[model samples]
Target: MKLLLLTAGSRGDVEPFAALARRAAASGHEVRLALPDRSGVDTTGIDARSLEADFSALIESQGVSPLAAMRSLRDVVRPVMRAVIVNAAQAALEFRPDVIAWHPKVLSAPLIADALGIPHVLVELVPVMTATREFPAAGTVTRSVGPLNRLTYRAAAGAGAMFRREVDEAAEVMGAPRSRRSSAPAATLLPISPAILPRPADWPESAVLTGAWRAREATTDAAAPTPDPALDAFLAAGPFAYAGFGSMAAGDPAARGRALVAAARARGIRLLVATGLGGIAVPDDARGDDVFVTRSVDHGVVLPRAVAAVHHGGIGTVQAATAAGTVSIVVPFIADQPFWGAMLHRRGLAPAPIPRRRVTADRLAEALAAAPAFQTAVEAAAARMADEDGAAEALGVLERLAGRPRNDALRHP
Candidate 1:
């Protein structure tokens, strides 16, 4: 089977799909990943392609920050998203994929799948796409606020309309019927487990709650030369707190770094800070044998060894922390991060998330002290997750949806 996967956003958003693509390829399927040129996805085994756009210019115009770039692109390229969808559809027509799997935000892919008469699956890393009464994650305003919700719906409808217009234009260019585009029965796959979020009464039966698709990281060989002896020595010392905002860099990271340093000192924990995308400038005077600063490290490699993890609550970081069975102290900056943080708190896996605006040295210290208890909850959750095979489960669903016979007769019989 040929599978075409589409996604956009930061590395966190793209990495999971890449993992899934690898899995599908391993299962003897041809997989192609269609992502924005700026997504920075590692195209190792899969055929990774990009839409027609100057990604570097987009990045520069939006500022070097990935968060800023995403917001800017969303606002500036609202129309372009339609073009992207049409282009991806055309690509799929050429590839003749057996299935079209896309991220939730890639709304165009669904439309394309409709046009091509192929099965589509929506993969959601965050819980924002589905509104469920069971989960308090979706904002009340989207459910209530009649006028506001209507407006939001209208905006979404408008975007869809614009996308249709673009698809018609592309069809005209290709000498095809503009009105022939049709939608298909879609499935939504969520990375969260039912343990955290039970099947909601309002949720569609098509949506599946699969555990996170965590990528396996290659083990760093002991024979490999250490990149930094100082950082190496710091890791060799007692377990330290891991701090980084992932792709969301702070406007004033030095001040934030200072606060983190102070908080670590207050909590009597060593600190390893990631200077995100050149945003965090650790002061010269702040450097010490106890304080280690680096650009970044593989979260899979670092999180398990750490006493606790502190992050901006990005989904990838959260999943990495969870998979490592390490407690997390989430400080959400923006987007769906706050949602993840709150969910963690509700699961008793972390303390109440410290909002970025409310983050201070004292509050951070308090959260750090409370983090140890979360390890127990995290361990229990990891144990349950370990028993479930997310990749295999998702693939099974996909195969069934694609009209292929199930691998196991016992389950399907």
Candidate 2:
């Protein structure tokens, strides 16, 4: 079976699909990853395809300001949706995949799958539109809007409808009858464990809860030795806290960086800060001796050595920290982050979420100090997640959808 997997966004969003692609290939299926041109495809073992005129420019645009990008996405939802549809159509025409596996945000894949008369599987990293009262809204705050959270529900449904329409258009373009579009069967794969997000009542039967498919290897470069001897000394001292806002550092980054530095110092712990897309400047006082600041480093390598992990609570970051068996201090800013933070805390795997608005040196210090107690809980959760065969399970589902006859060779051997 030939599988076309589509994903977009930061490294976190693209990496999981890449991992899935690798697993599918290892399982004897031909897998290709279709991603935005700017996503920095490694293209070593898998077939990598790009869908942009200038990938670097696209990434640079997104990296300018995390908050701004989020706001822009909210404001121009239609245009963004259209761009996704166009990209997916182009990829589908050329690739002619037997099945389409797409990230939830890449709404166009389902439509293309319908047009091509193939199965479409939506991969959700977070429980955003998955219909659970588990966490807060993925967007900015809002006042109560009445029963069933109709406002939020409508927003979610509208987004779903928009994608549905795109899929219908793609079907027409691919010469499928209109009636088929209305009845097209869609399936979803939640790339998170049920332990993190319980199966919500509102979710349809088509959706399956699969544990996160994380790569066994770290994709980012290793942290280089700090130039300052004091910083080097700190690294040698003991396991310290790893802190950063994954990609939400653009809004007041200097202030946020300073606050993180102060919090780490207040707790008397050494820190390694990832600058993310928007670079976080290390405070002059915190820079020279004790702290190390880098643009990026593989969380898989660093999280295990850390006593605690403080982050913005993106799904990928949370999974990485949890898999490493490190306690978490989630400071969620926007999107599904708050939901992830709340879920981790409710599971007793991390301290309570510290919303970006409420994050301070004192608050962060307290969370860091409390993190050690959560270690036992984190290890248990990690063990449970490790037991799930996500990549294998996803492949099994994909093979069945492509109408391929299942045999022992596909599963094992």
Candidate 3:
């Protein structure tokens, strides 16, 4: 089967699709990945194409403030999203895939697939679709608002509706008439650990809760990691804490880094900080003999060695920390982050989340002090999730969807 996978956004959004692409290729399917330019996701052993947008650069250049985002929505965000849709449509024409799987950001995939008479799958990293009372939609309220939880998903749907014009434009560019069809995917594949957030009872049968998509070689019984000698020495020094804010550039990064360093120092432990996407800036004054700062390090190599990880609550980071059996201290910046933090806390995996605005040295130190209480639960959850192969599960779903007869004349209901 020929599979075309489309995704946009930062490394977190792109990496999961890369994992799925690799798995599909390994399973004897032809896979092509279309993602943002310079996404930096390792897509070895797969045919990867570049979409025109660069979500990472966009985030880094413009801080994630609601006001700034709204101000630039028309001028910047729309054009970028339009470019992604057009590029994805172009790739679909070239690949002529049997199945199309896409991240939510690529809203044009379903229309392209419909035009091509193939199946399309929605690959959600978070449970934003498929409304349920289990929890509020991710990126909305972190805690449930009783019966109102189901309403939160409407906001996610509205977000997609905002790009309806782009979707229609993409269809025309693909030389297919504008599809008035609902554009709902044939299948929804969620690459989230059921152990972290179980499948909600209200989800449709078309949705499958696959475990977290991870590279088999990276997490499986592969050879021991060979981190840099400095990092290796730091881990050997003593129990250190890990801090990183992936792809979030909301506030003063230098101050945030200083707070993290001070908090770790207050706990009398060493610190290893990653300045990912420049959202964290470890000031020179804060860098002591006990503090190590790097632009990048393998989370798989470092998190397991840390006593606890202090990070922005990206689902990827959340999954990484949990899989390493490392407790977490989530300082959420924005969008689905607080949701993950609150869920982890509810599951006995971490302390209560600290909103990024509320983060301080004292608060972080307190969370660090509280970390040990959750270690046993974190380890147990990690053990349970160990048996999961999210990529394989998602590939299976795509294959099944591909086997179904094509709907060449799909129309909106």
Candidate 4:
């Protein structure tokens, strides 16, 4: 089968689908990843295809409050939605995929697939997309209430559907019948494990959590893929913490580095920071034998050995830290990040979330030292996560629609 994956957003959003593409290719299917823009992504094995626009540029690279980002993001979709659908539809024509797998935010894919009369799957990276009384909004740590929990779902879904107007335009683009919201994709795949996030009873039968879409080799042996001699020396130096905040730039980065170093000093631990696309600045003036800051480090290799991990509370980082049995300290910046931080805390995997605005050297130092006794449960969570094969499960869903190697792959147990 030939599968075309459509996605946009930061690296976290694109990577799950890329992982899925690799898994599908391994099973003898032709896979190509279609990006709104593929800049800065290592497309080595991604079977990469470009839709030719960067979402970050559309969204903004500077500090926009979460509410402002949400408002502007929705507005951008309204004006540019037609062009995006047309461009992605054109790209799909070039790939001529048998199936289209898309991230939920990439609204154009489903519309284009419907216009082309092809099956498409929605790949949701976070639980926010699902409506359920079992949980409240994905942007907040709201406790479940009678109908309020479900209302949050409705609001999120309804707001997202505002972009569906482009489907009417899609009809003219493909010269096909107008698409209907009632006719959603054939399936929805969630790349998170129930061990970490239990499946909500309110979620439709079509949606399934297949664990985090980690590579088979990664689950089996994380450190083997990208060994780092400098990281090895740092780890050997003493117990250290992993601090990574990917692509979430704000505030004085130089000061941010000094604060983290101070935090590590407060806790009497070494610190290793991954200066990811987040624009974190760790000046040499603040660096010493105990503080090591690198622009890149294979998180898969380092998270496992660290005593604890502190990140910007991306869902991907949460999953990685949990699977490595390391405790977490979430300093949320925006969007559903606060939700993940709260969830991890509620689940006993971390302390209360520290909002990016409240992040200080003293606060982080205390958090690193005051972490709960969550090692046993987190270790258990890791074992359960390792047992799940998210990519294989998602592939099974696709094959069922394509009628290739089909079986009882949908049963959650």
Return the top candidate by TM-score: 3
lDDT of each: 0.69, 0.69, 0.86, 0.74
Error of 2 at 279 (Å): 6.2
Per-prediction TM-score to the true structure, in the order listed: 0.83, 0.82, 0.96, 0.88
Model 2 score (lDDT): 0.69
Q: In candidate 4, which residue pairs get closer than 3 Å at backbone N, Cα or C atoms, i.e. clash?
A: 192-211, 247-278
Give the per-residue lDDT digits (tens) of candidate 3, residues 43-151.
7677999898988767876787777878899988888899898899999999999989998898888778877878888888888977889899999998789999999
TM-score of 2: 0.82
What CA RMSD would you report for each candidate?
A: 5.7, 6.0, 1.8, 4.4
Residue ranges of candidate 2 with Cα displaced over 4 Å: 53-81, 132-153, 160-185, 201-204, 216-237, 404-413
Over the stretch 1-413, how does candidate 1's per-residue lDDT look in tens digits? 78888776667878888888887888888888887665555677678777553333443355344456557655655544654656676667677777888875465565566555567887877665565544433322312343343233233334455455666665654445666644533577887665455566667787788877754443323233346777667777787999988666556778778888888988888999987554355788877777889977767667777888889888778877877788889988776677778878987989999877777889899999999878888988767766666676787778777743222321100
lDDT of candidate 4 at residue 147, scale 0 to 100: 68
Clashing pairs in 2: 111-167, 231-289
Indicate the TM-score of model 1.
0.83
Candidate 4 lDDT (Cα, whole model)? 0.74
Kindly list the per-residue Cα lDDT of model 4 for residues 57-169, writing each as its tens digit.
55445343555556766556344444555566777878777878887666667656655666778888887666777777777554567667766755556655566666566
Put down candidate 2 lDDT per residue, 198-292, tens digits, no spaces. 67665677777877885545432225454456544656678688887655544566777788889888888888988766535676766745578
